[model samples]
Target: MRRPSLPAWAWVALAAHALFVADARAAARFDAATRVFRLDGERVTYAFGINEAGQLQSLHWGGRLADGDPLGPAKSLPSHSSFDLSASITPQEFPAQGGGVFTEVALKVAYADGNRDTVLRYVSHTLERDAVTVRLRDIALPLEVSLRYTIDPGTGVIGRSARIENLGRTPLRIDQAASAAYTLAPQDDYRLHHLSGRWAGEWSLQQRPVSEGASVLESRRGSTGQQNTPWFAIDRGGSSGEDSGPVWFGALAWSGSWRISIDKDPLGAVRVVGGYNPYDFAYRLAPGERLDTPVFYAGYSDGGMGGASRLLHRFERERILPGGGKPRLRPVLYNSWEATEFAVDEAGQMALAEKAARIGVERFVVDDGWFGARNSDKAGLGDWSVNRAKFPNGLKPLIDKVHGLGMEFGLWVEPEMVNPDSDLYRAHPDWVLNFPERPRTPARNQLVLNLARRDVRDHVLQVLDALVTDNDIQFLKWDYNRNWSEPGWPQLAPEDQPKVYVEYVRNLYWILGELRRKHPKLEIESCSGGGGRIDLGIMALTDQVWPSDNTDPFDRLSMQDGFSHAYAPAAMMAWVTDSPNWVNRRETSLDYRFLSSMQGALGIGANLNHWRDADFATAARMVAAYKQVRATVQQGDLYRLISPANGSPRSATLSVSPDRRQAVLFAFLHSQSKGMQEPAIRLRGLDPRQRYRIARLGGGALPEAMPAEASGAYWMEHGLAVPMRGDFQASGFVFEAK
Candidate 1:
């Protein structure tokens, strides 16, 4: 007896959905059949190569035609249109870095014929973390197009390949390499702002200028082909193909842009497109031959940073749990890196635990220095076993005590590293990435693991699994302390070694996936030294990210601003660093650090145990204030109302709210001239009709009395202003919807 068959149309609809849903097949661990792909396996399971929750993955796409066949003949696109186009060649897959995703759709237009050229339309959707997106669309009446995605180490930005090929027959000639753009919703307060250009190798971030200003194109050596000249863009035109778009690209003084190029024409081979980033240009394709290679990333973030956050959550599912549940992060957490350092003993841990429990901190994390023979950074990185010197009776007692005290216990681990001075390195010298005969290059007092090798990745996984599976560890701070240096791994093929970046990152995803599945509720925060690895690719795997190395409140204006450019303020891991400073002379009032870092995931990076009673009182009050505003800030629409980068030391103001019902504003009085009057700060993106009440944050800190300095008037007539008479200070204002 057979069940009734579905209607023919229904069957077809179901099949289309299945194929549309699955751009490619992954392992059983991930059923691409569903929108959510759980990245849990040694084999590649996620089409998204990397998953750094905050922002760490950079994407690239490379492809070519099977035959040197120009998509000879022009045709129309899928949408309502009459004008059609053709392509030289179309490739299948894009490169993956850690947890990234991209799909190339090919539309076979009218078939190639002498009357006209049929089009092979190539388009793609790339997810760089959850926020950044790159969308590529190009059509040639008869020309070819190509590109590459390369990371520029110098600038910490990504650049494009410099070549485009002609897989067609006849001498292909393109008028020029042009037509590439990026799109964003206009509602976002942030603009596609430009940074200086010095890092040509990496069109990622620039502090040095390759060029500047509007109406001009900037040129620098390409990161991919290392060509003599390349192009970049800022903001320009509208959303249209064939040189009409908002992206500022191709040659000039105006800063900001990924690489792009133009091509005059190449006889029968590949011509040059925008170079440096795009490898080369399209050429005339001969039958049975194909055009080749590309590198690029296309990403999209809806309402600036918040939009990016949502996109990230949609993919990674990293969020705070309403009620404690499996796969949820403990509401309160404490770590000991800056608090106790390495010199502390068990008594110190116990004391910290005591304070932690009082504050409702549900977990206590012991950062580095508790593993192997490590009493300090000089030893015990690769050895995962507990150091008898630090914990004579093993981690069990501390775990038991923390549990008894009503808190979970977590620890830090840098599994992708090996301290040459440790036992692991001695046993497997070959496990470190290097040419068999070359000297091992160490970084951060350690060497990168050769995850490209089966054994090395397996070992890292085993140790990690042991820590999670064998102990009562509830969380992990997965730290990658260094970047890739001398990135040669003998275990991989020369061509495939290029895949190492994607592979190394994939290896990381594998470990995280395994641990998450087994523990089901293990929390992880991905950290890189401090923030070098903060990108979308890495964010997919972890819950949060460290925004930067500098934690000064004043300095945060720039660092946090830069981070918020591609990441959400909510995901930022900001801590209160020591004052007068632990690393710099920037002495920010405790009030400032707490408020600024409160814009993101809040934590105490400085020594909390040693804090003066006054500091604790101040913190308790401020943390409470944060609790009130945290929801709005985390889920509000961010507006870049003002910027110090615009040369106004007067201050910068950022506002947020769910439906404009409530608002929070931070206005800092930067710099003070002997006789200069205060500058008037204009506010935008507000409902002028609605009134708002104002109050200084943590105003309750003074129980004896409310100082006029702490209490302030809320106004709409002149907006809000803070004094800057002598040395500058930071102030925050709250605007409640009236």
Candidate 2:
């Protein structure tokens, strides 16, 4: 009963040591003898093996299992006549739509011999560190398929893709091919969660119960449309809260048209499949030709939706995004789109640049109207050359002014779209996507360029290259403002018309890659009228994405929540625009707007000229505060404490730095009730024994009668109260280990 007590510092050190060990154990691992793949990041396991019939069967996918415990005890085959109708009654690793198995199929191939039958049998497998490839072949035909699975041990994100080769004598057509098919063990109740919206209102999260039949979400607009996002999560109806329960989730890494199907079979078997949209899609594989599907990533989380999101965030930082290494802290930008849209001139831009720099902006972007007959959205799009009338001395004068003002310069251009009124379209009408005899349909008065064509692709690259070289451009806002209509290439043979979808994306990637090679320091943002093309495919090449055309901060709350479900905050470009907001005309406080936009890569899209001296001061101060927490907010694990969709009066997000020493909280109270008390929010992802100092950042009062410092354990257990009393009020705080 008489042991020497350790000092406070010693105790803190011991706690930090234990925290490191716990975090280290979260990495994923695979057991060969047990045939169990443990995704320890979420404490989940996936066990699978080939049955005696040489078919890959999914055995287990859920919470971690003991090393020697068998997953999914063997069940005898049914004596009823339904045995033939079911595919062995076991979860299939990759099921085809044939053979009387009525569940969702992952692949459908059409052969030249007028047969569409496919019966795959496991042939061989190769396993490497953190990756595996399982080969399968047709039981009768000469078709070969291989399933590739790669896992990022740190994040427990399993990436799955398929490779199909035409080993037969004739060509084969891939009528329907999914990147991956995931099946979860039967649960009492399943709820499917996804995002759906249109235009100014995009990425609105919606959750519905999984029913007996099938529910589908897809984009057939030839691009990742604003109508639907290609990501989903299924909870067992156990917990609806953001930070609780078991949830399974996946997202397709495709920027083009895609489809995701959630099917609940008769036996209550739930399966999710996703890949390229097969509608108007037919990939012809010639003899010896092989097609590789995009990667589909899936993960399991016992800590619920928030856990799944943080896993994806870490995976994107460590494994997905590339910028010489991990993506750097995104610069705080000031874009002039809202200020001088289509009215951009050297003098006006220079004046705006000075104001932006005065407000502590790190980047200044000149949006639209700087190029080719472009006084309006209807005129110059594809013409990348500067408009002499607007930029009389070229973009050089404005760019130099921005550089001298201590900010990098960026320009906006829709390289993939051409206005019918533009010089480029007038000279090369056939270069646009159109059938020989069909009328060309235009959106935004612009035609989609046939990037699938060699000439068109080359022209886009040349124009962009010259712009960058001549103007010393450090950044380009590459936009795709319209969807594909009359998608056809008459220059190609009739049989090869479908190649437009495949080749267009390929050529875009090539152009981006080539430009990157030439200008090593150049940065680009991928925009499709905003949030139209935000997907992992485009994310690989671009620095960030404009989530939506609506910069109303309140709307962005839900939009960003949905966007971050499958994407990292670093890739979600959120802007702070003027109030009496553009779309909703809902007036919000400047601090509220700043805090909302600060949740992601922060940028200012407000018309600086309309701002008063106080507004400028607030903007400058908030930008400085953002800089202090930029790295942590962009790269840390995100914990959504309160959901905006729940119609709550308040919403909060907490970001914990990689190290357990720092955390930042951005809390907003949309509207306060007459006698409502502020909620006490619990903090996560911290060393419990370590004490932290809580300090306010912007214009917000601290909790009433609360201490400025407390232990992490106390913060998590008892929590800290957020102040209340106002409509559209927001606050930010930082917690540092004391």
Q: Cα deviation in Å at residue 683, candidate 1?
A: 4.5
Tens digit per residue, CA lDDT, model 2, 511-584 = 98898888888999989988899877888888888889899998888888888888899777889999899798
Best by lDDT: 2
lDDT of each: 0.48, 0.82
Q: Which stretches of candidate 2 lie over 4 Å from their true place?
A: 1-42, 66-84, 699-704
> Candidate 2 — which pairs collide?
none
TM-score of each: 0.63, 0.92
Off by over 4 Å in 1: 1-233, 237-333, 356-363, 403-408, 492-498, 675-677, 680-691, 700-718
Which RMSD values do the candidates have, in order? Answer: 13.5, 8.6
Evaluated at residue 319, the lDDT of candidate 1 is 28
lDDT of 1 by residue, 1-738 (tens): 984698886765566446433633221111212222122112111122122121112111111112212221222112122221111211112211111111111111121453222222233323222122322222444433333332221111223332334444543322123222221212211223322222111112222222112122232211111111122223312331211222322221111111332211111111122211121212233333333222322223213333332332322222222122122322446777877777655777888787666544566888888888777776778999987777888888888999999988889888888888899988988787776667766766888877767788888888888887878888788877665556666766543343343345556667777777777777778675566454444555566766555666766666655554445555566776678766568677787777777666677666777778788777767766776776666555555556555456755545556476666676666677677766555454456676655566667322122222211122433555554455446666566665
